[model samples]
Target: MKKYIGILGLLTVAVIWGTGFVATAVALDNYTPFQILAIRFTVAFLILLGMNITKIKTISKKSFKRGSLLGVFLFLAFAFQTVGLQFTTPSKNAFLTAVNVIIVPFLGFLIFKKKVPIKGVVGSFVTLIGIALLSLTSSLGGINLGDMLTLVCAVFFALQIFVTDFFVDEEETWVLMLLQMGSAAALSWLTIFITGEGLPSIKMETVFPVLYLGIASTLIAYFLQTASQKYTTSSQAAVILSTEAFFGMLGSVLLLGEKVSINMLIGSIFIFIGILIVELDIPQFAKKQG
Candidate 1:
């Protein structure tokens, strides 16, 4: 039951994150990427801090350090992705970002000496193809500056998942989450000043989107990611979370009334197959049949 809950939690986050593209679009009208991140993480940190104030005393030095480390990786991932967007199209960025699904299992093996299940290796490849179909809607321009940065962003994201899986077992979930949020917020605030993009005046359009992103996408989704990793392997979690891209595509079509294409339907089917491959014991089933 705990495992099921973990799977469901990841799926829920995937759905919410899928919708973030729209909210981000609205917010971008009023703020730069750094400014948006500053607002999002600051609001999320405050909310998490408020909700968990009574338990602050329980967080140890080691937990704080681990969470801060993870937060730095998280910040790098988002910062690279946002900056990469300045030079690349969103479709290319989306495809490259999803490449982290392929990176996660390899990082697990290389860092911890943990063996990735054969199914996981195969599923990651399958999911990579699906993401390509869904996100590569345009002709390829030779890999440019933004594409390279987005690829680096994928590595950072993959590290975040594996590192969170490593530390979650040793730390309390809520405390770790709060520390991570706080650290990311601090870094983002610093970047805002360094970049010389002063805060723009806020309007109602920006207010609602920033609020949703801070509360739902950052606080709730990240908390769920930390907690759910307790019950799921890092590679399995990566495969599940990769569905965020699929959900993002679906949300655009449904909520924004964007037209769905044949490629989108085909890509969704491929992703479903990839997820099933990771979640099921295919080799054991084959043995049973024999």
Candidate 2:
């Protein structure tokens, strides 16, 4: 069914993004965070533009508006996350950013008047705990400016997901994707200028990782997401998409030769449990049993 396809597509996206952790580690060795963001979006835009050149004639004003709005949210989410990392530990930044899983369902209710599913609410909490276990290091620290910015980043990411769900069916998927990337690329370059972040040297070491992130993470993963959201509710999609953290941990082990801890194993178990709770509509089963 389409729902299963959507779930599969989103899982694929999560896997690709999880692998992005490794690519990002390599890319960040040479490039500033903003520089990586700029190049990644720019390369994604160029590739998407090339692929969708003939389809450009079909783009409409409404579609462009919607796509551009998504681009704004996408850029803000990345921008905030990058800046937030400067002040917060990577663990806290990652955990705070994952809070978008909880925000998406509420955002839908508040803005669109959609009825939220009970399973999604429960799954989100479980997933939050899972992410906490996975990403949190050392003692829980006091909240700070970086934490607030990362939380804002989470909100923008939730917006990006909901908006993509809203407009994917209304516009040409490929063209919608193209405009979104093009808009983000423009914003990223502007941010680079404002921050005075210079571009990294063009070298095999940096370019390859950036190219992988652009082509695999931005271009392909987002196209899959935009297409997949049409077949699933945003709440369900959010839960599924969050498996990226688990996959990121997996990538760290396999690709980076890091050892997994018991905490991580437990965290991965809870994450999959959360995914199954959302995917299977477990609350409905509970009601039937009662």
TM-score of each: 0.83, 0.83
How many residue pairs in model 1 have overlapping backbones?
0
In the range 1-290, model 1's lDDT, one tens digit per residue, is 99999999998887787777566655766778787788888899998888988988988898889999988998898888777766654444555666677788778688778777777767777866765565555665445777688779889988999899898888888888888889988899899788788875667855888889889989999999999999999877877787776666566666657666676567656766776776677877457445
The sequence of per-residue lDDT tens digits that candidate 2 reaches over residues 1-290 is 99999999999998887787667666767887778888888899998888878888888888889889999999999888767666654444544565677788788789879766777667777866776675555667545667678779989988999888888777878877888988998998887788887755788755998899889999999999999999998877887887776676667667767667676567666756766665575657569546
lDDT, candidate 1, equals 0.78
In model 1, the Cα lDDT at residue 218 comes to: 91
Q: Give lDDT for model 2.
A: 0.78
- Which residue pairs clash in candidate 2? none
